[model samples]
Target chain A: MSALFDYTLRLADSALILGHRLSEWIGHAPLLEEELALGNLALDLIGQARALYAYAGAVEGKGRDEDALAYLRDCGQFRNLLLVEQPNGDFAVTIARQLLYSAFAHPFWRDLARSRDATLAAIAAKAEKESAYHLRHAGEWLIRLGDGTAESHRRAQAALDTLWPYVGELFESDAVEEALVNQGIAVDPAALRPEWERSVQAIIAEATLAAPAGTGMQSGGRIGRHSEHLGHLLATMQFLQRAYPGASW
Target chain B: MSAGLRERALAAASGVVDPEIPVLTIADLGVLRAVRLAGDTVEIEITPTYSGCPAMRVIEQELATALRAAGIGKFRIATVLSPAWTTDWLSKEGRRKLAEFGIAPPAGISRRSHFGTDAVACPRCGSAETERISEFGSTACKALYRCRRCAEPFDYFKCH
Candidate 1:
């Protein structure tokens, strides 16, 4: 149960952090259509996070609900990937992040749809379809930016290169996930790497963007270690609850 | 009385139009999954069209309003996610209504349908000669498209 709780929290935290990161673009996205798109994707990720958080709370047999789990947790308590917490630098950087994260998440959710845990399977079934849209949306933009023009290609490539090191942490497998994997309740992140590579490489190749050369991999997010950006993010996201406990509309 | 209450609840719930897509009722959109009567209480189930659809809270309020208006004193609304909602669940009436409202219905083409591979008939001129402008559109469930023949841009409710 503890393993399941930890595994679910990992998924939940990643979704929440990434969703909050994307929500930062609500008023700042370049185009109106793109703005709506990013907002919509944020909404989906947050919704998935809510569901996962609720399940985690249930697994822990605690009184914590989604709100408590999401709003009350400190920065170090978060288990999201380092990739999700990095600043959404620019339009190109945002697209690069989405492309990389969705590339892994799309297949991860799809495979998770068949989990022995019925609740996880059901949530993943819905999330898989949503993530597929994100992957497609991100892939198209990455290709256009990478292949479009000299300036656009340069920015896209630079964004991809900068974000590439964080990708390794997404495929890291640890004991919590390993136990759940043995129980058929969780997926092995390592097994998802090959498929993630295929889709990401294809999109990158089509975009005329070369994959970044090997570099020092970033990890530790899964165990609650995160980038400095997460603290500021949580400060804003949890502000309302911190100021006024149990407040509601 | 139980049977009659169930029927009344169903009627009220079915008549509740989707807040986002006004032309279609919850029933037409398949958001109204099930309605049941437990003695004197009414229970309803609904599913989101998309994981993050914003219109769900409004729909819930509208349902409560409708039930009260129908004189259903005790009722419950539950959301279920086991079988994810899909565009395939959108009824024929809903699709026609969508087209009539100047929005193209789901083209029955999966999102994977590359740029020009699938022909999503334009709602304006019924033209199969259409091009997708953006995979993400005004809403999560839609994609932006342009009719080559009509020279008009429109929203296509892309398949999930």
Candidate 2:
């Protein structure tokens, strides 16, 4: 596969898995409006995934369109970050992951939204706008959960404590970043780490939540290596694709 | 008479406004990703921005009814999962349509976020002095921005 496809698949896979997880909250969210909000964010993620996949398809000139890439891809092929595929866990865990992912993504999309490449830049430009909203929503909830009831606060704090470990993987960079950034095809996540930390700390502070002490980093989610949760997600997501095999609507 | 079906179908589809942003039609939001004349069954592909968006089914039914009222034929509004819809697809014309309806569109800042993209002028007052209030706006799909120059609140359809 071409580097373009790999890079694009990484972006698409991140959103696809995360979006699928968020969709689980459609009717089960804490509040009705929130349920709607999560759904909205999920759609945005799916949309971003689509654009990346479609563009990748177009770039690779693969007969495999966006649907093919999304619905047909096998388990090992997905390259989403580990945090995204992790189960929504408890509300706090969900927010923790949301905060981590969206924090990194907020800046990531902001930069990519203005890409040197028109197609990618255009897609990023669009995704950044949505990411801003997602960050805000998750941030507010983070504050509420951190400050709400004692149980809520305790759970939220614990959630962050566990999730904090995995957060490091998002900023992990290697050859892909080197190649893509040097070529201006991808933005460097390393540069965004400082801002992400500051923003997360500030939000945690305002929520009266102490930032959890960092533990050893749990890395390896971005490069097709993920937490245990992703395989189960693929089993569900790919079921129709695998079962039907080239079935189209 | 047959052409009238196409006209009516579009009008009905126009009635398929966004459930969140009710002022704008599906067409206005560009959520109407594609409309195809696949034989007699008109195939409509909608790329919704939000997952399980409540509006999708409504919009699909709306399109069906709108086209039905126009009286030509059968159509299936399919949700395309891949190449998920992005705000970038929200056209400049669509942005204008949204504003005319009193909703603000995303600032759609330049794709470069490393050094700097040109300042996003206010859609309300064309003021470069605008500031982002929140990355998340009223909807999950947009960001909140305020213009100091105009002192008005507006939404920036997120770049993604």
Candidate 3:
């Protein structure tokens, strides 16, 4: 596969996986308002995944369309971040994961909006708006959970500590990212790290939550080496497609 | 001949109403991008206001039905994601229609304000004393708001 195609899949896969993860909370969110909020964010991510997958299909000059690319792919072929594929432990854990990912995604998409590639730029521009909302939603929840009752604060801190280690992989540059960055078609993930840190730290301070001293970077999702969680996620996500072979609404 | 055919197709497609907000037509919402004749087939392009808008499929199907009813046999609907759809594209007439139907039209283009304090005028009382109940409303494209003056809850078509 071409670097452009690979890079595009990397983007699409992250969105598709995260979208699926959020969709799991549809009927089970803690409250009605939160249900709607998570559902909307999930839909946005899925929509983003569809657009990116469509573009990737065109770039690959392949017959596979968005559905084929999304539903047909196995866990081993998926290219999402390890952070995204991790299970949604609790309300606080989900919020922590979202805060981290959306913090990274907002800046990443903003920088990507200025890319030389028109299609990528357009996608990034649209995604930037959505990611900003996602970041705000997660950030607001982080503050509420962190600054609320003692139990809530304890759970929020624990969630943040558990999720912090996985964040390092987001800024790990690989050959595909390197080539695309050099071509002015992709954002340099490493450059986004500082801004993400500052934004997260500011939110942490406001919430009265201690920032976790992250260690032991876990990587390799870009190359399809995911944690054990991804397989079960794909099992549920790909079930309808696998069962019916050709299903449509 | 094709140019005239395209106009007829556009006219037909304009009749398709938004599934979620049924009062406004797709054209009014600026979802219908273009209708054209490609060889013997009619081609239409539509943009989605939100990425996960459930109405897109319905709109596309409705447009096809409308086109077929207009004596156009072969047509294709393509969704263009570029130049992303924004609330700014909503026509003045569309805004009026939304307000008439008890939904407050978006105040301005959706921008992330740090304060989260956009003054949404209540459609019922036309009062600026409305407060946001939730950032998300019944649908993905709207926000839930309550009018303090009129004591009525309504949906605000969020700017996006």
Ten residues in a row with the worst lDDT in model 2 chain A? A219-228
lDDT of 3 by residue, B1-160 (tens): 8888988998999889999999999999999998887798998999988877889999988998898899998999998878888898999999999999999998977687543757899999899999987787788789889999999999999887
For every prediction, compared with the true complex, DockQ reads 0.61, 0.15, 0.65
* Higher-lDDT candidate of 2 and 3: 3
Native contacts present in each candidate (fraction): 0.61, 0.19, 0.61
How far residue A39's Cα lies from its native spot in candidate 1, in Å, is: 1.2
**Candidate 1 accuracy as lDDT:** 0.90
In terms of lDDT, model 3 sits at 0.91
Output the number of the DockQ-best candidate. Answer: 3
Which residue pairs in candidate 1 collide? none
Ranked by DockQ, the better of candidates 1 and 2 is 1
**Candidate 3 docking quality: incorrect, acceptable, medium or high:** medium
Assign candidate 1 its CAPRI class.
medium
Off by over 4 Å in 2: B1-160
Task: List the lowest-lDDT window of 10 residues for candidate 3 chain A.
Answer: A124-133
Q: What is the descending lDDT order?
A: 3, 1, 2
In candidate 3, residue B2 scores what lDDT? 84
Give the per-residue Cα lDDT of candidate 3 at B72: 93
- Candidate 2 lDDT, B87-107, residue by residue in tens: 667767778877676556655
Query: lDDT per residue, candidate 1, B30-66, as tens digits?
Result: 8899999877889999998877788889999999999
Q: Which stretches of candidate 1 lie over 4 Å from their true place?
A: B109-118
